[model samples]
Target chain A: MIKKIFSLIIIAGLLTVFIPIILNFSFQTDLPDVAKSYVEKGSKDLGAMNIVTAIIVTFRGLDTLGEVAVLFIAATGIAVLFRKNAINDKRPKQISKRDSSEILLTGIRLLAPVILIFGIYIFLNGHLSPGGGFQGGAVIATVVLLLFLSDSSYKINHKIFGFIESFSGVSYVIIGFLGLVLMGADNFLDNRILPLGEFGTILSAGAIPIIYTLVGLKVGTELASVLDNMKGDIE
Target chain B: MTDVFIIVLGLVMIVFAILALYLKDLVASVIAAGVLSLFASILYLIMQAPDVAMTEAAIGAGLLTMIFLLAIKKTKQIEDPND
Candidate 1:
């Protein structure tokens, strides 16, 4: 039954997908006008090396904001669903995870900082590279996961998580408002709020880098907090 | 060369998927699935979608695997109370 259903679904999906794809698709190298505009004007207008980053953080700022908000909601939902695992549980837990070896501990201590710096590099270089806020944030969460595994007693303070999460979220909205205030109504989420510095440098891309950084912080905190909530508290 | 690499990766990924399907041990199956995801991420990297590749590596291979392992452990602990 399951195989039959799966095959039926696959057939239906292919039937719906291939018709539009084969009919509307063109092999020509020429892009649509909108894409052409984005390619031609993206770097000059946004001063970002990555045209994709410019599109996400500037041209399609509202969509990115919505994406961030959706992630925040999903994280919140996970936390709520796992409410029993929150830090305040007083139940005596089985000592499941054993302590790491000294060598492992030492290795983690050395490697964690490097992993962290790489994650930050991805965050900071979003405009100049393929990685950006979401990728960088996941890398940060991986760091947190490493720390959590190496030591069970490693407690993530709610204060710090809340601060980073809320601060970045609020600041993201404020930055959008700043763009709206500085540029006209049509220029909401404008990267031109800050000076679009020389391209390929860290300081380039007006507010795109700042926005991406804020997004990274927000996403990282949310993911870390989600991991924390899932860590069934040790007694 | 790239085509050969792609073919090899695709074959390995299919092997992992089939192993995951046939494995009796849940943990082994989960590991196979994680390996599959990691391969998919590598394929994304080769296709120049580093953003998608990074996400698949971190979330699909890493986080989801950890979560599934934990869930399996919890279920086993509950089921075989003597263990």
Candidate 2:
């Protein structure tokens, strides 16, 4: 009775909120004039054909840095949770024959690579499109999850993840610092130092797409590793 | 028509999400939550933010649901009168 009442109240609240917001109905179809000019200029200045890439990597690189830290923290928290505790000392059970579905396994095997390739393509072409690090990273993690679902035998190496997590974190920071050294203190992750390639090309975004790719790899690997750790605990 | 379709879909998704939260069976609730997230991802796509949709599908539907299922497996389900 309580649960039902609570659910009704919540549903009513959402309906109330959504009705007003939907009625107010202004689609944000156009960027502000100043933002549009900046995007146009950024495409040229940052050597990125994709304005969003330039914005994420150069304009908001600090936010990306903090995001990486959050990933690290999440990984640490999961690791802590999975630590050998007597209270939660349930060992991972073997995958039962009944629980295994061949169709799911086969389909995942066929699709995982395609999804991963598509994710990489998105990351590589971020300088020329709307897709960037976060989008591509999430895509890659989806592939990892698919693999996990398909086969219980599969496992990720934790030592490698430790290296990857640390190296990527360090390199990202180092690259940002390098911009400081080369560009004479304009800003960290400033694109002035790298040669601006031809517009609309994959290589055009100077270091923006490169940084995004690294970030994608780091994020994808970290998330996959966390899920893998959870699997070990589950069994 | 497109706007109406979007609103209807959003309503459907919210309804499912509320059901998922209020459901008594933990496993059923988890699956319902996944369905809710999948619907929410579709809603994101309708909003012209495919990137957001992709993230929501991957993280909200995929990872979060998996995590919840694993958590449920580790712990015992609570008996509810509603069930």
Best by DockQ: 2
**Model 1: per-residue Cα lDDT over A1-235, one tens digit each:** 8998999999999899889989998777878999889987787888888888888999899999999999899889978877764546566767677778999888888999999899889989999988899888988988888998898778888898899999999999999999989998888889898998888899998998889999999988888888776675642
Clashing pairs in 1: none
TM-score of the candidate numbered 2? 0.81
Ten contiguous residues with the weakest lDDT in model 1 chain A: A84-93
Worst 10-residue lDDT window, candidate 1 chain B:
B74-83
Q: Which stretches of candidate 1 lie over 4 Å from their true place?
A: A1-28, A85-91, A94-97, B77-83
CAPRI verdict (incorrect, acceptable, medium, high) for model 2? medium
lDDT scores of the candidates, listed in order: 0.87, 0.79
- What are the clashing pairs of model 2? A91-A235, A92-A235, A93-A235
Name the regions of candidate 2 deviating beyond 4 angstroms: A1-30, A85-112, B77-79
Report how far off residue B78 is in candidate 2 (Å): 6.0
Candidate 1: deviation at residue A224, Å? 1.0
**What local lDDT does model 2 show for residue A106?**
81
